[model samples]
Target: MKKKSAVLLVLSVLVIGILSYIGAFGLNVGDYRVKSFSQMLSKGLDLQGGVSVVEEIQGKADNTAIEKTIDLINLRINKLGVSETAVSKEGNNKIRIDVPGKFDKDEVINLIGKTGKLTFKDPNGGIILTGDDVKDASASISQETQKPIINLELKPAGTKKFAAATQKFLGQKITIYMDDQKITDPTVDVAITNGQAIIEGSASLEEAKNRADIIKSGALPVKLKVVQSQIVGASLGADALPKSIFAAEIAIGLIFIFMLLVYRIPGLMANIALVLFIVLVLFIFVTIKATLTLSGIAGLILTIGMAVDANVLIFERFKEELKLGKPVRSAFEAGFHRAMSSIVDSNVTTIITGCVLYALGIGQVKGFALTLVIGVITSMFTAIIVSKHLISWAINIGLINKASHFGVNLRGDNNA
Candidate 1:
C-alpha cells in the first residue's frame, strides 16, 4: 500500500470508531437528537419499566393447553399495539407476561386477563354461537363503501348453527358481545349459509384488525386467573446501565494498556481493531433491534475479553516467528496464518453454542445468546480482517519494522 493510502486508511478507521461511539451513546445538536442509540435500541421491561402479570389456569390444563393459552395472550398483547411484549410459560399451569413502557396498570390488567368470550345473541337474548365456533378472522376493506371491515369464517358446527340462526332471524339483528359488552349488532339481511360473514362499521383498518384479533384470542382453550401482578420500576435497570458502561470503559482501557505495554506495535494494531469490533457489534445490535438486557451486557464483556485473547495468540505467534529469524513482514503473515485455525475453531464453537441457547432458552437467556452470537462474529472479523490489514499496513509503511518494536528477542544474526 502507498504511504498516503495507508495513512488515510488508519485515520479513517479511527474516525469511524469515534463516530460509532458517538452514535451508540448519542449526541445532541440544538433541539434535535443527532445520533441517539437509546432510540435505536429496544429496551426490555426490566430496563424501561412496565407491568408484569402472572396468571394460573383455572381448571385442568396440560403443557399443550398452557402453550395455547400463552399464544392467545401473546396475540391479545400484540393487538394492543405493544411491542417487545413477553409471554412465557412459568410452570405446569402458569404463564407470565411482561409489557414494557408506561401504561394504565388496571386497564392493561383488565385487557389481558379478560376472557373476552365473544358470544352471538338473538334479539331475545338467547345464545346463538361463541368465539370457539369461529375458525379464522381477519381485517379487510369493503369494496362498496371503501371502509374497513372484519371477515370471519366459522367451523363446521358453527357454520350449521349460524346458518340456521340467520335463516330464523332474517330481517332481525344478531348482537355480538365480548365479555357481555355489546360490540356490534348488525341486521341479518340474508342467510349466511356459506360459513363466512363480514362485520362492517369499523372506523379504520387497524381497529378492524384489532377487533378480529381480540375475537380470535377469545377462543383460548383455557381460562386464566391472575395470581400475581405488579408494575416494575425502571430505577434498578436504569442505574445498572451507567455502572455497566463504566465497567466496560474501564475494561477496555485496561486491556488497551496491557496490550500496548506487552506486544508494543502489534498490540496497538489489535486495540484499533478492538475499537472497530465494538462499534460493529453495537451497530449490528441496533440494526437487528435486539433488546439489551443485563445478561446481554455480560455476554458483550465476555466477547471483548475473547477478542483480546485472539490478538494475544497472534502476537505470540508473530514473536516466535521473529525469534526464528523471520523478517517483520514475513513474521506478520506467518503469525496470522498460524493463528487463523485456533481463532476459527474457538469462535465457531462459541457461535454454535449461542445458537443452541437461543433456540432452547427463553427471556434473558435468549438475550445473552443473541449478543454472544453477534459478538463472536464481529470479533473474528476484527481479528482476522481489521487487525491483519492495519498491522500489515504499519509494516509496509515502515511505521513499524524493527524486531524490538515487535517485542521479539534477536537470536543469531540471521534476520532477513
Candidate 2:
C-alpha cells in the first residue's frame, strides 16, 4: 500500500506539472495544436479595446419589435467582420452594442443603427419594389462572368412587380438604391416571371457581401437614435492586461510561500491543490468561452484567497487532532469531517451571493459574478477532494506521520 501510494503521488504531481506547462505555453503536435489559456479565453470590450454604442428607440415599441431590432442590428454588425460582437437590448427602449477590437466609432454607429431601406426604382425615379419584398440575398461569384455578384431572391409579389417593370422598360436602366443612395443600375435585357436576379459589377466579394448583408437585414422595426458612443484604445487594454497578470502571479506566489511556511507538509499538499484549482478554473473559462475583464480577474484573485482559507481551516483541525494524540490516518479523517460544516456554510453563502450578482448585474459586473461563481465551486472541489486525497496518499506512504512535520508540537506524542 505504501509503495502504491508513493507511486500514485509521484504520477499525480507529474500530470499536474505537464498540465500547468501546457496551460501556460500550449502544445503543438503534428497538425493539431492546443491553444494556451490566454489565447482560448476571450477578452471583453474593456480588455480588448473596442467601440460601445447605446441607441434609444425613438417611439414606443413592443417586445417583439425590440427583439427584431436587436436581430437586425446583429446582422448589420456581422457584416463588419468583427468577432465577438454583442448586441443586446438594454432597457425597454434602448439597445447596447459592444464590438471588440479596434473600429471607428462613427462607422459602427452608422452601419448598426441605420434603417437600411432598400428600394428598386425605374429611370423615372418611381419605386418598383422595396426591401420588404425581398426574401433572401447572398454574395457569390458569377459562374459566367467570374466576378463577385449579389444573388437576389424576391417574394411572389416582388417577382410579379419586377417582371412587369422589366417588360415595360425593356432595354432601359433600372436603378437600385439603399436609403436613397444609388447602388446599381442595370439595363433590362430579357425579363420573365422568375424571382431570381443577379446584381453584377461589384468591385470585390467583400463589397458584395456587405451590400447583401445590409439589404438582407431589411429595415429596423423602429427608428433608433444614438444616445452614447465611446471608443476604447488598444494601448489601454494592452497595458492593463500585463499588470493584472503580474499582480496575480505575485499574489499566487506569496500564497504558495505562506502555505508552505505555516502548515509544513499539509501546507505543501494544499498548495498543490491550489495549483490544480487555478488550472481547473481557467479550463472552465476557456471551455465556456467566458469573456475575461479586469473585474473578472479580481473575482478570481478573491476566490484564490477563499480556497486557501478552506485549507487553513482543515489544517488547523488536523493539528488539533494530532495534538490529541490521534493516529495520522484517524486525524486526517477527523480533520476534514470537523471542518466540513464550516467550509460548506461559507462556500454556499458565497455561491448564493455570486448567483444574485449575476442575475442583477450587467456588463463587467456580470463578468465578475460569473467568474466568482465558477471559482468558488471549483475551489470547493480542490480544497475538499483534491487536497484530501493528496494528504491521504502522503499519510498512507508513511511520509507525513510525525506531528512535527505538520508544524505541531505535542508534549508526549512525537509521531502521529
Candidate 3:
C-alpha cells in the first residue's frame, strides 16, 4: 500500500472506533466482546457522582468475609450493567462501594445489607431451613438441564437440621429461600436425609448464575453507613462535555501544528503517533470498560502530554541522526532505539508510582493511576511500533525525500 493509504486506513479505523463509542455507528460485536476491543468498562460512582456509601464492618471483620463482600460488589455491579465497578477496602474495617452512574441505590443497598440467608425447601414449597446455617454455597450447572444452579453443603448443624426438614417434607415440594424470598423450589421424590442439595430456577443462564452468586456470597458483613451522597445533575455533565471537547481539540491541534513547523517531517510523524496514542488508549478504555470521570479525564489529558514526551525524545534523536548525515530510515530506527532508555526510565518511574497509588489508594486515585499507567504503556507501544512503522513506510514510498523537510524545515506544511 502507498504510505498515505496505509496511514489513512489506520486513521479510518480510529475514526470508526470513536464513532462507535459515541453511538454514531451501530455495531456491537456482543457482550464481553471475547475477541473485540469493546470491553464493558463502566464508571465508578465517584466519577459520575452517584451515592457514596460507607459501611462499617465492625468488630472482627473476617478476611474471608471481606473477600466475599468484594465478590458480591462485583456481582451487583455486573447486574447493574456497570463494568468493573470499584469496591475496595477502606481503612481496616470499612468497605467502600462506588457504583458508576445512577442505580437503584436503595434497592441495591437492601440487597447488599441482608444476611444473604439461603434455604432449601421440598417441592411442596415447605420450608427446609438452610444455614447462614449455610456452611457454604456455590453456583454450578445442572447436568440434565445444562443451566446454572446453586449448590450448598450445609454445616453439621445445618446438615442435621436440613436432613430432618427434608425427611418431613419428603415427596413434597421444597423451595430455597434467601432472606424469605424463594430462590428455587425443587420437589423431593424421596427422602434427602443427606446434607447435599441443588436449586435450579428456570431462568436465563446469566440471571440464574448471578442470583446464585448473590446468595452464595451472603450479605455485606457490616451495616452500611451512608457517610456521603452526591448527585451530579445531568445538566452539569452536559455543560462540561463541550468545554472538555474544546480543550482536547485545541491541545491536540496545537501539538500537531507545532510538530510540523518545529520538528518538521519527523515531528509530523510523532504527532501522528501521538494521535494514535490517544486512539489506542480510548480503545483500550472502552474494551476494558474504564469509566470516564472528571478525574479520569484529567488523567487522560496528562497522559496525552506525557505521551508526547517519548515522541519528542525520538524526534530529537532523529534530528541528531539527520544532522550527522545518516540515512533517514536508519536515523529513525536509531532515534527510537537510543531514546528508548530515557523513555523506559521516565515511564517506569510513573508506572511504579501508579502501582503504589493503586495498592494504597482508594476511589478516584486508583482510577487515575490505572488510566495513567495504561496511557504510558500504550504511548510507548505506538511510539515504538505504530509511529516508526509509519515513518519508515513514508520514507520507502518517497513521501519525505529530504532531511530538512523531515526535520524542522518544510514547504507548504502548516501542521506544526
Candidate 4:
C-alpha cells in the first residue's frame, strides 16, 4: 500500500508537470494545432485591442427598448463576422460595445448601429409587409436566371398580405426598401400565393449575402447615436504580459525558497502543490474560455500568497503537535486535522469576498474577482488534499521519520 501511494505521488507530479507545460506553451504538429493556449483562452479588448463605441439613445428609449436594441445590434455584429464582442448598458440611456481584435472601423460602425428596416411597399407608398413578417432570409442562386438572389420566407400573415398585393397588381412593381434605401423593385409576372419571395439586384454573391444577413438581423427597437468611438491599441497589454510573467516567476521563486527554508520537507511538498494549483487554475480558465486581463494576473499573484498562508498554517500546527512529543506519523495526522478549521475559514471568507466583487464589479474588476474566486477554490484543494496526500505518502514510505525533517527540534524525543 505504501509503495502504491509513493508511485501514485510520483506519477501525479509528472502528469501535472507535463499538462502545465502544454497549457502554457501549447503543442502543434506540422500544419495542425494539437493544443494552443492562445486559441483556448479569450482575450479582452484591453489585451488584443479593438474598437470601443458608446452610443446614446436618440429618443425616448426605456430600459426594455434599450436592451432589445442591444440584442439586435449583437445579432448584426455577429452577422458581420465579429466575435468576442462585449455589449452592455453604460447607463440609463447609453450602451457600450467593445469588439476585440482589428476590423474595418467604418464598416463595423455602419453595420453595428444600423436600424435595418425591411419593408415591402406598393407603388403608392403603402406598406404591405415589414421585417417582422420575415421568418428567414438567405442568399441563393436563382435556378432560372443563375444570378444571386435573396430567398425569403414570410410569416403566415405576411404570406397572405403579399399574395393579396401581388394578385391586385400582377403587372406592377412591388419595391423592397432597407433603412429607407431602395433595394429592389420587381414586377410581379403572376399572382404569387406561396409564402416565399425573391429579391434580385446584388452585383455579386457576397453582396447578396450581406444584404440577406442585414435583413435577417432585423431592425432596432430604438434609434441609437454613436457618441464615442475609438480604436484601442494592444501595446500596453503587449508590454505588460512579459513583465507580469517575469514578476510572477520571481515571486514564485522566492516563495519556493522561503517554504523550503522555513518548513523543510513539508514545505517542499507544499511548493509542488502550489505549482499544481497554478496550473489547474489556468487550465480551468482555458476550459471555461475566460478572458484573461491584467487585473486577473494581479488576482493570481494574490492567491499565490493565500496558498502559502494555508501551508504555513498547517506546518505550524504540525510543529505544535511534534512539540507535544507525538510520533512523526501521528503529528502529520493531528496537524492536518487541527489546521483544517482555520484553513476552511480563511478560504471561505476570501471566496465570499470574491463572489461579491464579481457580482458588483465591471470589466477589469470582474476579471480580478473571477481569478480570485477560482484561485481560492483551487488553493483549498491543493493545500488540503494535495499536500496532505503527499506528506502521508512520504511518511508511509519511511522517507520522513524524524521531526527535524519537518523543521521541529528533536528535544531528545525523536520517534520513528
Best TM-score among the predictions, by candidate number:
3
Best by lDDT: 2
Which parts of model 4 are misplaced by more than 4 Å?
Answer: 29-32, 58-66, 103-105, 118-130, 135-154, 161-217, 413-416
Candidate 2 per-residue lDDT, tens place, 1-416, comes to: 88888998999888888899999999999999999999888888878899999999997999998988887888778767775787777767888999999569988998876778889999999999999889999999989989999898999999999999989999898888877667678788788469898887789998898778767767888989989999988887899989999999999999999999989988998999899999999999988878788999999999999999999999999889888888777888898899999999999999999999988877778789999999999999999999998998998887798887788887754454
Better model by TM-score: candidate 1 vs candidate 3: 3
Q: Which residue window of length 10 is worst by lDDT in model 3?
A: 32-41
lDDT of each: 0.83, 0.88, 0.68, 0.84
Flag clash pairs in model 2: none
Candidates ranked, most accurate by TM-score first: 3, 2, 4, 1
lDDT of 4 by residue, 1-416 (tens): 88897898788879878877877788776897657565677778887788888888887987778877887777667654666787878756888888888546786688777768789899899999999988998998889999999898889998999999999988899987876777678888787789888877788888788777767756888878889999888887688878987999999999999999988888888999999998888888987878887898899999999998999999999999999899988888898899999999989999999999888776778889999999999999999999888888888777778888888877675565
Clashes of 1: 0
Each prediction's RMSD over C-alphas, in Å, is 5.0, 5.9, 4.9, 6.5
Tens digit of per-residue lDDT, candidate 1, span 10-54? 796778777776876787778987666667777778777888888
Clashes of each: 0, 0, 25, 0
lDDT of 3 by residue, 68-98 (tens): 7778766755665655466778888777776
